[model samples]
Target chain A: MKRAELIFQSIALITLAVAFILFWNFGKGVSFAENGLPSGPTVTDSYVVLQENLNRMIPILLGSILLSVAIAFYLEEYLARTGWKYQIIARQIIILASIPSLLYGLLGLYFFVFQSKKGSFFIHALTVVLLVMPRTIQSTQMAIRSVDISIREAAFALGAKRWRVIIDHVFPHAFSVIMSGIFTVISRALAIAALIIVVYVWTKHTLQSGDTFYIPGSAIVLLLSSLLSSVLSSFLEAKTNWD
Target chain B: MQSQKTDPILHIHDLNVWYGKSQILKNLTFDVLPRQVTAFIGPSNSGKTTLVRCLNRLNDLNVNFRYTGKILYKDENLYAPQLKAAKIAQQIGMVFQKPIPFRKSIYENVAYSARLRGIKQSDQLDTIVEESLRKAQLWDEVYKHLHTSSDALSNGQQQRLCIARALAGDPEILIFDEPCEQLDAAETPKLEAIVQNLKSHYTLIFVTNKRRQAARVSDVAGFLYNGELVEFGQTEQIFTNPIDKRTENYVTGRL
Candidate 1:
């Protein structure tokens, strides 16, 4: 690794760790009980919060990855051949990818929460899916495009049709790069989604009461997950780079 | 028709090719006889590659590529809307200047082309793979390590493997676009021998910038200069006799 990347990685790790530790111990010694047991009014159970978040997140992650890959494949392999429309659509997707996650949350809130009166869980999960998909689609498209043209030519020269070239040659050759792209985008999206959720819950809790404090366990899980995922993504990108 | 067997396998007429507005090959005409090596020789940027690419319609992959040509393979229009590039490619195999082996086991590398043509039974695949490798003159070196990755092979062996891969598809016409350009001195002879041997069964179109290589391998030879066919005839005549001044200058290394 370059010295610059190493420095940046170290700094990021230290910052996240320090922030997490400070948050974990924020209200620990703020008050003392009559029995001398330090206790601030505790909020909701951490385990329940963790479980509920998992119940929402897993489905969204899987669904978003599948949906993004499909959209990306259609855009690249099929739509890309259609000329001007593909160029316009590709540019629009890039713009969508750069849009803030907060906008997606508000859109989901309007559609699923207000219009249909669905549960917050449905709206929340959908919001995260929408938030993650654009970036994932972009990354997937890049991965597919990065496949060596010669490989495709070789397959075509052997009488493989466009679909066969994609299925038999292109996909297998681009698999590791595509996987790395997926992991990297998912990691970033997970961090963003977790940040939004934590802030949202904390704001609601603070407005409702002054004494009680809550730290959602989902925050820690997501932070750890995003860390792990980012590391895995880096490893995959570096190690499997055939070039 | 038995008489058709004696006919020119490929007949290219008034072929003009361009990438965007810039012309590459201009008004090129040629006939490649069956069961013979017809070589196209020219210096770089003389439209040699473009002309060879036109044979199997491989240039269609380029969005900017356009051509005015009649390429007849077995008297049928090659550029006909009804004919798919894949189907055209099946009958016409191409080997590039650089050898590109798929990241696959040596067995799979040869078998892949067969599998694409829907040959599913393992025994049939095995036979085709063996036959192709033999024809490529690589069977002796690689037969024991057929399951190993093709990446393990040397550059020359990889080139031969590419030939085997092309052969596995059972193409009626094989196009070698500067096939020996990347091969070393030791490997070039082997490739030349394979081309010589292949001509008895498959019609061969060999393209090269190497004048002597063309002279050594080709039965009929075409000299391309500035997107035009300068001279074309039997190899000996093109090499020795005075025809086009450009052809003489090229073969004699005065160009």
Candidate 2:
């Protein structure tokens, strides 16, 4: 690899390791009472709270996965292949990826939570989608870009149209790489959803009493599901060939 | 020189290609007659591959690539803006230097092109897969494992499978970009024979640095030097009595 790429990769690794260490620390000293829940919470009590949070998280997880896949398919296969729209969408994804998650949480609270008034689960799900969409689109675009030009040429030369070539030739070739990106986004979405819900729960509890503290429960379930889903997705993705 | 009355399947007139600001091919004109093997012989980076890519508009895929050329297929102006790349490719298929089968079943690899053209019937697809594999001379070795993953095939089989995929499209012209470059010396002749037999129906355009391979397969040969067509004629004339000193030196390995 080039020296510049090597340096960039090293910095990225160090940053990731530091972030993981911090996140682990946050999980270790986590307390439900800080967010206004009743004190003296046991493991079983935490499990019951976690089960309630899972009910909200399950749909958010499924929605994030489905939406990410759909957005990836559109961007990689359809939008990226077209003229003008490709550049526009690409720039939009970059801008979205650069935005902070706190901003997305605020937007979700204002728009999806207050305007729609569909309760916390739906707002949290929408927030998760917004948080993950940009990275998912970007990574999937990179995956599609990494595909060999010759493969697409061969397919086109054989008379496959833009849609047909992507569906038959490009998608199968880039599926594993795109799946990896989707899994990355899924894991990110899981963590970010927990953070957003914690922030939302805290803010709502400060406004009034009887507001349930959903953090410890949401964090536990998010951790477990992120690990489980990532492992499952990786297994399915590993069975396929990327080259 | 002998001139046959058969209409050329593909005709290039004043073809020129450019990569960004740098011009590559300049005023290249040639004709590939139907049912004949035409070889493009040149040194490395001489634009032989670029020329063949223009046949099916594959060069258009490059972001910096541009060209001013008239490529005619069966007397139809293929370079016209109205003609789509996919339509042009349906008429002219390309096989790259390396075999690239999809990460799918062997049967699906052969059936892919046909399916792209809307041949969804299982029986029709089966017939096409069988016929294409037979034509590529790969049927006997892979018939039993049609449903197996294509990656399971050996290198030679994968290369032949690429040929079968091209043939499945039923293109009138088939362009091979150094098809045997990756094959071992012993395996080269097997693919050569397949190309030799393929000339009866498909107009073959092969790009190769190997002079002997060109002489062995092509009826007409074009010698390219630094993106220029130095000499072009019957393979016998170009190989035995090349008029240009560059061509002579190139053929004799003196350059």
**Number of the top DockQ candidate:** 1
For residues B82-102, could you state the per-residue lDDT of candidate 1 as single tens digits? 999999998899998899999
Task: Score candidate 2 by TM-score against the native.
Answer: 0.77
Q: After superposition, how far is residue B236 of candidate 1 from its true place, in Å?
A: 1.4
Interface RMSD of each: 1.1, 1.9
Question: What's the true lDDT of residue B200 in model 1?
Answer: 88
Maximum-TM-score candidate: 1
Residue by residue across A1-243, what tens digits does model 2's lDDT show? 699999998999999999867755555455676667674333334334445666876777676666766676676666524357765665566656656554565566555534565556666566677777777777877888888877877777788888887877777878898888877776676565555455555454465665554544554565455546555554455356233
State the lDDT of candidate 1 residue by residue for A1-243, as single tens digits.
699999998999999999867755663443324336433223233323445666778887888899988888888887634378776776566656656554564455345433474446767776777678878898889899999898888888888899988988889988998899888877776666555444444444444555432233343454455546555664565456524
The 0-to-1 C-alpha lDDT of every candidate, in the order given, reads 0.82, 0.79
Query: Roughly what TM-score does model 1 have, to 2 decimal places?
Result: 0.82
Reference-based lDDT, residue A213, model 2: 46
DockQ-based CAPRI category assigned to the predicted complex of candidate 2: medium
* Model 1 CA lDDT for position A229: 58
How far residue A236's Cα lies from its native spot in candidate 2, in Å, is 36
